[model samples]
Target chain A: MNDKKIKNVFIEGAISSEFIGRSIAKHQTKTSIGAHNIFLGQVRADEVDEKTIYAIEYTAYKDMANAKFHDIREATFKKFDLTCMHIYHSLGTVKVGEICLFVFVSSPRRKQVFKALEYVVEEIKAKVPVYGKEIFEDASHQWKVNS
Target chain B: MNLNIKYFGLLTEVTLCSEETVPFSKATVSELLDLLFEKHPDLKNKDFQVALNNEIVSKDTLITANELALLPPFSGG
Candidate 1:
């Protein structure tokens, strides 16, 4: 049960580049980590029915989503030799061309980091109960579903 | 018992309220859903799964007095 808890993943709005840079900087002291893989999810301006998506408003069943993220984190650690993993996602409106999700994974070798990064991102896409409603240029909205 | 129920995402569009405490007798998840459908007819057609205490539960699961949320499909990256 001690391993059941995890760090919070939700950020109020879009994740900034400076924060991400600092996260990477903080890990430099750990000489054991040789390679790091980063995955940044950006909001795309997809055209739907002549309406262009300007922003995505995100919401989640936070308690459950965080728990699922913890499960994913634990599973990823068990499956790979990793130094550390950090995940942060936006909770509110993230505009077009904005970074919404940041996943950082590090390992002692390039191969482990490569494999582990994909596993964590894919697991989050499939399991986390977070919703995004796409707001169009004309102020219309539609719920987004992962393909 | 008065149970607390929460709705998220698209389901909140139908219920209009995110959380509510409603009176309920002991029942299965499916039966509680039926009551919800009666209150918000629009929810009957929405696609979602029931979670009791943060874990997704099947319709046959007995209703318990705890955190309950109706979660719509995820689109998160």
Candidate 2:
């Protein structure tokens, strides 16, 4: 993983399928990579108090969140043998059934990518300073907490 | 010194603003919380952690940065 600079992993809205496709296409030249694992987090229309969630408005402590993402990336690289890793998270309103998070990891072996992908995703959920406000169909909202 | 305080997640709903500045003398993190609790008493009941200069600090930690953020539980995936 390019350990040169802190990469901003945030996108304004949903992580579109086109963007994800382009990312995968760009890695074709990395011939040494034998396996790639991807994890996409989609928003669910959960019912709370009988009100269905329509979307989630995501917000973040930007500076700190970016710093935390950088730390997580560094830690994951140290713990796993990965060739490359990329994480993209959505900010602003993401409707239900849309992709909100995308985690991609590549390695020379299948097992490394599988283990690295899970570790990276778990670290992001637990350590990132991003908040999601679950907006219901009635326009009311509640803060989402990771279980 | 003056501290730029940022509120995120549910804390913003209680504070009614995302960012503000509060003047304070040199003190510990808990002292700053007392000042904030006085202004927005509801914040005392909200679950959050204080980050000073992008690093989470304990209440007993001395204030060393001009920037601070109150972050609630993370829900990012």
The model with the greatest DockQ is 2
State in Å the error of residue A86, model 2: 0.3
Query: What lDDT tens digits, residue by residue, belong to model 1 across residues B1-77?
Result: 88899988788889999999889888899999889899999998889998987788999999875567898888997
Tens digits of per-residue lDDT, candidate 2, A21-135, equal 9999999999999999999999999998889999999999988889888988889889999999999999999999999999999999999998999998999998889999999
DockQ for the candidates, in order = 0.85, 0.91
**Candidate 2 colliding pairs:** none
- Model 2: residues with Cα > 4 Å off, grouped in runs: A1-3
Docking class of 1: high
Scored by lDDT, model 1 comes in at 0.91
Residue range with the least summed lDDT across 10 consecutive positions in model 1 chain A: A1-10
Task: State the fnat of model 2.
Answer: 0.94
